[model samples]
Target: MKLAELAKELEISTESFIKFIQDFDLELSECIATNFDVKKDFEKFAKENKSFLKKYDADLGQNKSVEDIAKNIQQPKDKVAEILEKDKIKVYDNGFYKSSISSYGIHQKLGGNYQFVYDYFGKKTNLSERDFIGYRDLFFFISKTLDPFLHLAPLTDWGIHKPAGIILYGPPGSGKIFWANKIAEIVDYQFKQIKKYYFGTSFVDGRRANFNDFLVEMMKEDKVLLFMEEFDVIMSERSEEKSVSSCDEETKEIVLHYVSQFEKEDLLMIGSANSLVDIDDEILAPGRFDVTIPIFPPNAHERAEMILHYLKENLSKDAILMKILETNNAHHLPFWKEISSKMKVFSNTMIIDFTQSLKKKIRDIYLKNSSLKITINEKLLESAFREAAAKLTGEYLNQVAQFLQDVSINNYDDFPKRIEALKVELDSYKMVEKPIKTIGFTHNGDQES
Candidate 1:
């Protein structure tokens, strides 16, 4: 019910309702003034409660008072006071409040600052380090390149000194963003991530004045790292036609300007692109991006390490199976997450059993989908399932069958019925079956049917 309606039903004005809440020692002044409906208030209350429960590891039923909550949740009294003021959930000196007000406020403030900075500077912090591979060589390179930056000493002319810009070029799934973040963190500089679209816009506008303003602000700060991901769209060469105006030209010019400025001001700039050759010659020339780091696809050794990392953190046991399934050139993180989610349903100790079970599941899926009577081992089954799942399409019943074949079932016969039901569900989308080739029996001398 709406607060106003509830207030009217109780035969009191909103202000009076708020006062009544205060009497109960649960502050409602702000909530009443804001006129936020009861639904929103309840949601906020529930979220705060959950956060409090998680943080304190306390049982909600045991505590009902704010003082009890503050003590249990291990938050400062002032922090609790602020939450009471904002939520208008009457906090009697004894009422329960779950989330720390100061922490929540600080988090929100930081998020807002990030958003404002991103809007103005066209940069964000992409600090997900889950994709770095071949740690030995990469680490060696990082240690070497970042040594001077870390020590706050001028590098020799051979070293990367006052680098205007550096390019991280490689195939997708290469750890460009991860490396960029590590560099920023090591240097104790603010890392800003800029999206591809922002660069495209900057290119067309001839000048990203607003973005430049943000960059200038960062310049005033002690140290900053501006990371532009998918840099090809902006830094790529413009068309030869003088009359033609493309966003690419404007982007290159703006980037060039920034690179030159950074060189003069001793700022660090990094750009990442999948296609290195697409980069504009003007920007790639001597002063702009002098150091070009090619982030090659992970070789066998790196792949092995990445597989082990995923298994250690995400897998229960089945490391062998995880390694087998970690093929296909797509990004590794999503695949790892999917496998991790799948493994969660089974017992951690039973990973070997689960691996065998998954193999059977994949075989069943393949048989149900494909016309070929192929004999698939556990490893093969796992690979097939991974591939099908990776590239599964709505139109392909076989792909759906391949994915669902391994799922747990209480009734085996009902599985087919469940599949039929899925077909019916998919009928609304006008999905068509992909044609499959008929497999003919191969014979040397003996005839086979």
Candidate 2:
């Protein structure tokens, strides 16, 4: 029904009716004749909105407040207030305060529809639980630690608090970020990337206030997975040697703030860094960031999994996946499997690089020599894999590989020092000079190293 008609029928003002429609996050261009007709389906929409209002009312039953309910439901009270809007819900005369979501109606909306909720906030990737390969032991560790509170059990009946913090320390492209994201996906929590760019402002007071406000806002969410990459930049152990910037002090405050929250809230902070030892002792102790994991290069089986995945993902358009899987063909699944077996201890990035290089090699050949046909066969992929493996695994080159994975471009000031340190570390091991040998893969998956 049109706003005027609905208002007249219900004996309310037109402004009031319009306000009701606006509650559902609808924007009006204002009622020209066509604009009014465009909203003809308002009746059905209003019914759904009525249900949400009813749920909100039930949530507030027995004169319960938003803050109490927010704590009970693990949602930020401010977020509840935002969703409920100030018009429909009462607000404090002085200012805003924290709140939580306590209504079962909201829970009904939230229970099985995490993706929907995240979609309302913003769309997530289509990556599912299976899409996250490896990290089996780490997954178990996370689940075991968080099992106490990572459920929908009633708060009044049982004791529950925010789960312990987790630090995923690894070299770059070791899958720390990917695993953290997958964890958030499976847990069905709000996933937020703690972008360093947000803290790049120069004004001290503004920086401190911004950090404080953002944390306050984040706390209101029901369940949040905060992923901080290059985490040591902000949360590294505060040292007297460092320059005294206001943001430094502010960063210290925020780190301490999250530590306290982790003890009693539902938020989970997942930070990734080059090394766990770089973090402060207090933060790494029993309660805050209790789990410090070291993710290393993938093992043989894991490397194989990653190799097959990337190969299919990038080269599938050329029907290379079929050649690998088809048993009757000379270059079949076992041939690929054996290739993956040989790629032991390869980093995930190296596998991706291998795929790109292999594809580029073929494309270059096709361009340079039009008469030579490029076939996506086992031998071609095997040769590319062999070539990449030789470069990544040789004695001095292995040290270089580690250096590339461990160092970030932002550490330009310390690059020389870091390189020297790594060189010394590599030098400590017995030096062995060996030829970079390339292995040839056969139809039967036999290889000569």
Best by lDDT: 2
lDDT of 2 by residue, 290-403 (tens): 665555556555566565556556344346333433432422234456666556445678777776777677667666776334555767777787666553534423533444
Task: For residue 180, give model 2's deviation from the true position in Å.
Answer: 1.1
Candidate no. 2 TM-score: 0.51
In order, candidate lDDTs are 0.46, 0.52
Query: Which residue pairs collide, candidate 2?
Result: 70-100, 70-101, 76-220, 77-99, 77-100, 162-265
Prediction 2 global C-alpha lDDT: 0.52
Candidate 2, position 219, lDDT: 80
The per-residue C-alpha lDDT of model 2 at residue 181 equals 77
* Best-matching candidate per TM-score: 2
lDDT of 1 at 310: 39
The backbone clash count of each candidate, in order, is 17, 6
Can you tell me which runs of candidate 1 are displaced by over 4 Å? 1-133, 152-160, 196-209, 241-245, 263-266, 314-449
| TM of each candidate vs. truth | 0.41, 0.51
Q: Which 10-residue window in model 2 sums to the lowest lDDT?
A: 26-35
Model 2 per-residue lDDT at 300? 56
